[model samples]
Target chain A: GAGVSQSPSNKVTEKGKDVELRCDPISGHTALYWYRQSLGQGLEFLIYFQGNSAPDKSGLPSDRFSAERTGGSVSTLTIQRTQQEDSAVYLCASSLTSGGAHETQYFGPGTRLLVL
Target chain B: AQSVSQHNHHVILSEAASLELGCNYSYGGTVNLFWYVQYPGQHLQLLLKYFSGDPLVKGIKGFEAEFIKSKFSFNLRKPSVQWSDTAEYFCAVRAYNNNDMRFGAGTRLTVKP
Candidate 1:
């Protein structure tokens, strides 16, 4: 409850279907981030939300991917038309503030997404 | 653009053995360094970080890392490891004033009893 919480610890869906992953960050945290960890690959930055500033979606692999943080607390990452390559561990993290010289990010038990 | 590299993909060690995992990054500007651990079936937890002050920083569970700015290296070390230490480790960094913290591939460490 105190830490970042992600829904559907595990989800398996058929290819070409859409999937939405949710993340609830710690209270008072203003900065939220989404990352993907593919098998044997590193954690890839997917998106970042800072306060009210425009989210940096530079890491989204394609236009098919998008995310939104409503009310600065709950965030969701949606993958449209999932493919085999879309299977990975979806991780969510949040920091106390969006900006600062150095801030630690608390992570959640990633949601394991599988596309069949 | 910034990226992180973990030298060893897999490392095997015996109980009480010394351990070191190398991490390097390519970034021209200032950055913050961090090491996170993920035990089997657990979420990623912060092991340590290097923001400023001492380059050689100590972290939880008797872990430590030294940030070598000139070489752009931040390596994790443990004097003695135990079987319970087996886990996946990740290194990350964020720009001097940025919100994005890029992560390294990750090193799987298995300490045998």
Candidate 2:
């Protein structure tokens, strides 16, 4: 079976620029998530989409960071006016169901974004 | 807001040596714990998880984690590690009621042959 996939494995952009990172979840998956992995900062949850709706988006750091999942299959995270602090590897993951005591998530190759 | 902590930043050991990585979460509610591993240039993969029942849960590659509710800890351990076990390990947690998940700063393990 095909696993989760992400595009543009690496991206380099200037400060104040906007960038969009894409994620394709596995077929039949209903839940999608985006995370940011920064140096010495661990994995920070960005957003989660159950189907095409995002019920919990409190993890988004700021208004400049937004994500949307279309048709409950693909998700895109857009960071507007990116800052040097936004430099990190963006990771995406998906699971079978939305709510579970323990839902195993499959991850995709992260997109390394460097804000210079 | 919930948070997770990985006390160790990096570790190095010889093959056949025992390994232990400490993890702690700052949530008191019912939670699910997991151990994820990322090999060199590879995506993250699930190692093990603990939801309920037995406090001691075993994972792939001879790895195991014990959940101590009293201490709010889930520490991963392995006996007689192999050089292939060298990688970055991350501990994650998800509450029982919400879909939000949190992960700790990963610990990089290097097992020499």
Interface RMSD values, listed in order for every candidate: 1.6, 1.3
If you score just chain A, what TM-score does every candidate get? 0.96, 0.94
What is the C-alpha lDDT profile of model 1 across B1-113, one tens digit per residue? 88999999999999999999999999989888889999998889899988889899999999999999999999999999999999999999888777667899999999999
Give the clashing pairs for model 2: none
lDDT of 2 by residue, B1-113 (tens): 57899999999999999999999999989998999999998899999999899999999988999999999999999999999999999999988867778899999999999
Docking class of 1: medium
Best candidate (score: lDDT): 1
Cα-based TM-score, every candidate: 0.96, 0.97
Backbone clash tally (model 2) = 0
In angstroms, give how far residue A108 of model 2 lies from its true place: 0.6
Clash pairs, model 1 backbone: none
Worst 10 residues of 1 chain B by lDDT: B93-102
Clashes of each: 0, 0
- Among incorrect, acceptable, medium and high, the docking class of model 2 is medium
> C-alpha displacement of B12 in model 1, angstroms?
0.8
Best by TM-score: 2
Q: State candidate 1's DockQ.
A: 0.72
Candidate 2 per-residue lDDT, tens place, A1-116, comes to: 99999988999999999999999999999889899999887889988888756446888999999888888788899999999999999999999986664578999999999999
